[model samples]
Target: MTEVGILGTGAYVPDRVVSNDEVGAAAAVDDAWVVRKTAIRERRWAAPEQATSDLAAAAGRAALESAGITADQLSVIVVATSTPDRPQPPTAAYVQHLLGASGAAAFDVNAVCSGEVFALASVEGILARSGGHALVIGADLYSRILNPADRRTVVLFGDGAGAMVLGSGRGARVRHISAHTFGELSGLIEVPAGGSRMPCDPAALEAGRQYFTMDGRAVRAFVEDQLPGLVKQFLHEAGVVPDDVRHFVPHQANGVMLDTVFEQLALSRAAMHLSLTRYGNTGAASIPITLDEAARAGAFRRGDLILLAGFGGGMSAGFALVEW
Candidate 1:
């Protein structure tokens, strides 16, 4: 069997930097309150003309360059995003066109913030059988769906995209990947009016049901009650112990919640990778963006164990183990 691994990684954030003060003012809070709550001072917002595909393409170009491959060499392109440019035509299709990856099979996966890991797991199987390179991208434009006056969701997200080029041979070899969804808790995080069930009609728009909404306390509790055990069980199933992991790249949901869960996991030797402080939560892009930053900074060594964990809307979670 050919070994599939991440050949290269890349990420891109918009140029417009939004400060806590700016976001807080709209949310009826202040900089201190925002910082004390999210540990985030600022985040990036996409330009008026920029869409999710634009950011994904930029990141994809960088990953291709880093991997020493051209866009035409890609056999698959999977974009994980909850915010598609439109309701029809998958976001990955636009990304594929932008990158000129004419031959690749392109699609989108929406597991909300856990989309990236889900896309990775999906692509791994495709590449394993097809024997070709693939590009997996996580991108979101949360700023568009956020309720500006709602502190709960508005101040916790930014616009960005992260990408990884996967192929058979050398790189960070993927060990195992797992995903779970708690459908009963799906309403914990949602945009209540956009889909078929609710349709974004005039009434829905007037009702403010189009905005992204989340039950913060419930989400925090879910993470606290479930993440650590999931991580432990995932590791055990993969035949690895917590001590064997050297790096943990998790969804940049909330700094405080992450701190609480980190201690519970007891990965004493592992260094938790974070980009939320500077990027807020980039939705599905969070984990890959953090991973790309760490990789560029020369953070991993050969034989090092890296864990990628993602959890969010759908009340879902995804985990992956990689050997560097």
Candidate 2:
């Protein structure tokens, strides 16, 4: 069977930085309270002119440059984002245009925070069939959907993008990839309106349905209950023990949540990669952004065993084991 894996990676964050104090004031909370709750000191917010595709394109260019490939060489483009520029067209279409990847098959995927991993799984066939490469980018403009007054959801999100160029039979071999979704818990995090069920209007706007909402308690409970088990299952499938893994790149959910999950999995501090403090949770872009930072820092040794785990809204969870 043909092998498909990452060739190069890239990430981009908006220039506008929002400090905890600023966000706290908007949310009617103290700076200390905000920090204690989300473990985020600050986060990036997109400028009015910048949209999700702009971030994705910036990251895509970096990834392509890293891989020593041009946009036209890519056979497929898969973008995962919850906050699209508009509802009518898939965000990938704009990203494809921006990247000048006119020949690539482009589309979008939304599995909430698990989207990047989902996009990876979705594009395996393209890599295999083309016997070449594809670009998988995870970018989300969460700030666009946030309700400024709702600190619970607002403080936890940032806007950013991460991209990876994957080639057929290449670097960082993917040993296993898996995902599961708990639809019953889908309501835990959502943009309540603008969809077919509840079209956007003055009434929906009045109800604040246009902004994203999250059931913090339910989401916390769900992650505490399900994520660790999924991680264990993933390791089992990869036929590797937790301690043997050199890195555990998990979703940037939060400091407390990630620490708890790490403890439950019996993983050590040295084995974890975290970027929450600097970026908070960039939704689908979190894992790849974290991975890119680590790679750029020369954090991994050749032949190292790397594990990627992500879980979030859609109550979705995904894992990928890579031999670096």
Candidate 3:
């Protein structure tokens, strides 16, 4: 059997930097509070003209370059994002056009913060059958949907994209990937309007339903109830002990919830690769962005075991165990 794995990874954050103080004032909290609660000090925001596809294209291009492959070689393009270029014409189409990967199958996946992990899992499955390279990207432009005045969601999100090119070869094989979704809890975090249930219009805007709203308290409780135990189970099923893991890469959600997960798993802050403090939460793009940063810094060694887990808005969570 041909082993499927990432050939190269790349990430992009807009040049525009947003400090904690900027977002903190809107959320009615000081910079210290933002840092204390979420450990996010700064994040990048896309320029007014930049959209989700622009960031995705840039990251995808870099990934292709790193993989030493051209866009035409790509057999598939799986873009994971909650914020697409538009409600119609999936964001992957735009990215595919930008990359000139005309021959590849293109589509978008929306698992919110867990988008990349789920997309990667899908890419692996696709490659298993197709036997070719695939570009998996997680990109989002949260600033557009977030209520500028709503401190809860605005302060925690930013604009960015991350991508990885997967192919058949000798590389870090993703040993195990498991995912589960709780549809009943989907309402825990969401954009209340714009979907079929509540179409976007003047009434929705006036009611403030158009912006992204999150019950921070509820989300924290939900993650606390789900994530740590899921990680432990995934590790157990993969037949790997916690100590054997070289790195635990999880969604850069927040500090408070992360603290709980760390305690439950008995791991130190250093063991869990985190970029939340600097990049805030880039939604679905968080995991891959952090992975690209770590991989670029020469973080992994041969035969090392790495764990990747992500959880968020479909009220979903998943983990992928990799052998480097």
Candidate 4:
């Protein structure tokens, strides 16, 4: 069986950098409070005119350039985003058109923060069973959906995009991936309106239910309790042990969450790759963006073990181990 791997990787953040101090001024917290809570000193917010597709296109082009492939070479383009530019037309088609990838099939994935791992899993399935390359992009302009008045949610989200080219390969390739969801426990966090369950209406807008909300206490407890065991299960299932793993790229949820998981699992920062300090929690884009940055920083070699893990809304989690 031919193995699938990332041929190239790319990521893009908006030019505007909003320091924690800036956000604190609006949200009634200090910079140090934000930093201590999220480990985020700064984050990028999209310009008022910018949208998710714009960031995804930029990241896609960079991935294509790094892969030495043209837009025409892509067999598929999967965009994973929770915040789409329009509620109607899929963002993938818009991105595909902008990139001039006329022949490539395009669609969107909406697994929220677990989106990239899901996109990567989908790509692996397509490539292993067939023979084509895919450009998977995870982009989110989450700030658009945020309620600026809500300190808890708004402070944790930023806008960014990350992409990777996956194709059949021999070295430093994706090997095993899996996804699990606990939909029954989905109430930990979510945007109550804007979807079918509670369609956007004038009433919904007035109530301010359209913005993202989370039970911080619930989230903190869940991560502290469930995440470590989940990581162990994923690594063991992939036939790798904790000691064999080289880089632990987890969902950039927050520093507190990551620190809790690490401490519980007895894992060291030396075993992890992180970008939360600069990127905040970019939802689905977190893992890929972190992966791209780390690779550029000479974080891995061909035989190193790379573990991708995420736990997010829908009470969902995913993990994958790739040889790199």
Candidate 5:
């Protein structure tokens, strides 16, 4: 079997920096409260003209440059996003057009924040069989869907995109990938009115059902109950122990919740990579964005084990182990 690996990684957050004070003012919470809860001081927001595809394309270009590959070399372009540019066409189609990757198959995957890892898992098989490079991107424009006054959500999301180029070459060699979804808990996080279940009619708009919402308490409980055990099981299945892992790149969901899960996982030798302090939870973009930041910072050593984990709406969790 051909070995698939990350050829390059890249990320793009919007130029506009939104401070805690700005979001807090709308959510009726002070900076201190926001910081105490999420450890996020600021996050980026897309300009009115920018959409998810714009960010994804910018990041994709960067990743292709980093890989020393041209867009024409790509055989697949997969965008993992919850907030698509529109309902009809896939966001990846827009990204492919923007990048001039006309030869590649384009599509979108919506595993919510877990979409990146799920997309990675999907592309790995395609590229392994097809024998060409693939661009996997995770992007979101949460600022557009957020209810400004909903502190539980609006304060926790930002706009950004991250990408990775995969091929049979140097870089992080993917070792194992796995994903799970608990559909019974789907209501824990959701945007209630945009889909067929509840059309965005006048009444839905008036009810504020179009805005993103979450039961923060239940989500926290779900993560606390499931993530650690899942991580342990995944490592065991991957034939590695916690002590052997050197870096832990997880969804930049909540700093405090992550701290708790980090402790429970007992990966004592691994350093947790976090970008949420500056970017907040960037939906599906979190893991890849954080991974790109850490990689560019020279955080990994040759032959190091890096674990990537993402968990979010769809009540899903995805994990990937990479040998760096």
Candidate 6:
């Protein structure tokens, strides 16, 4: 069987930087308060003209360049996004057109913040069976869906894109992957008025129910209890110990959640990678963006084990063990 691994990686963040001070000003809080609470210093926001597809395309192009491959070589393009450019045409198709990957199959996956891990798992199955290369992109234009007045959720999100090229018969290997979802808890964090369940209406719009609503305290409690077990189970299933893992990249949710999981699992700060302090949470794009930065910084050498875990709406969670 052919092993699948990342051929290249890239990320794209908008030119504009929204610091804690700006958010605090907009929300009637202090910068220090926001930073101490969320551990977010600044985050990138997409330009008004740049949609999710545009962000995905930028990162895709860089991934192709890094892989020394052309767009024509791509056989599949999977974009994971919650905030699509529109409700009809798939964002992945738009990205494919932008990259001129005319013959490639394209589509979008929606699993909220767990999107990238889900997309990667899907592509892994495809790559392992078929003889083709895929461009997997995680992009989110989260600001478009945020409510400026909703300080709790607004402070935790940003806009960015991250991408990786996956191919069969690779030099490095994605050794194992596991993902799970609890649909009963999906309502805990979601846009209540966008889809069939909560169809858009004049009333919904008037009440501002169209934007994202999160039960922050509920989500924190749920994740703190469930994620540690899921991650540990997968690592043991992968036949590796926590100490053997060279890098641990969890979803860039917040410092509190990050610290909770780390503390519960007896994971030292040395075992993890921290990017939320600088980039905020870019949803599905978080893990890949951090992975790309760490890779560039020579954070891992050959034969190192890299552990990735993600949790968010669906109330989904996933874990992957990669050998770099």
Cα lDDT of candidate 1 equals 0.94
Residue 79 miss distance in model 2 (angstroms) = 0.5
Give the per-residue lDDT digits (tens) of candidate 2, residues 199-294.
999999998889998899888899888877888888888898878788999889888778887788886534889888989899999999999999
Q: All predictions: root-mean-square deviation over Cα?
A: 0.7, 1.2, 1.4, 1.4, 0.7, 1.3
Give the runs in model 6 whose Cα sits over 4 Å from its true position: 268-270
- Badly placed stretches (over 4 Å) of model 2 are none
Question: What's the TM-score of each model vs. the native?
Answer: 0.99, 0.97, 0.97, 0.96, 0.99, 0.97
Scored against the true structure, residue 32 in model 3 reaches a CA lDDT of 85
CA lDDT, every prediction? 0.94, 0.88, 0.88, 0.86, 0.95, 0.87
Candidate 4 lDDT over residue span 1-324, tens digit each: 567988888999999998887777777887888888888888999999999999999999988887888998888999988888888689999999999999888999888888899888887888888878889999999878877766787789888999999887543588689898888779988989988999889999999988888988898787778888888787778887777877888899998778778767655433777898988999988998999999889888878888888778888888888888
Worst 10 residues of 4 by lDDT: 262-271
Global fold similarity of model 2 (TM-score): 0.97
Clashes of 6: 0
Candidate 1 regions with alpha-carbon error over 4 angstroms: none
Clash count per candidate: 0, 0, 0, 1, 0, 0
After TM-score superposition, the amount by which residue 185's alpha carbon in candidate 3 deviates from its true location, in angstroms, is 0.5
Query: Which pairs clash in the backbone of model 4?
Result: 302-324
Q: Compute the lDDT for candidate 6.
A: 0.87
Give per-residue CA lDDT, model 5, range 1-324, as digits (tens): 678999999999999999999998988998899999999989999999999999999999989998999999999999999999999699999999999999999999999999999999999988778778999999999999999988988889999999999999677899999999999999998999989999999999999999998999999999999999999999999999999999999999999999999999999999999999999999999998999999899999999999999999989999999999
Per-residue error (Å), model 2, residue 2: 1.2
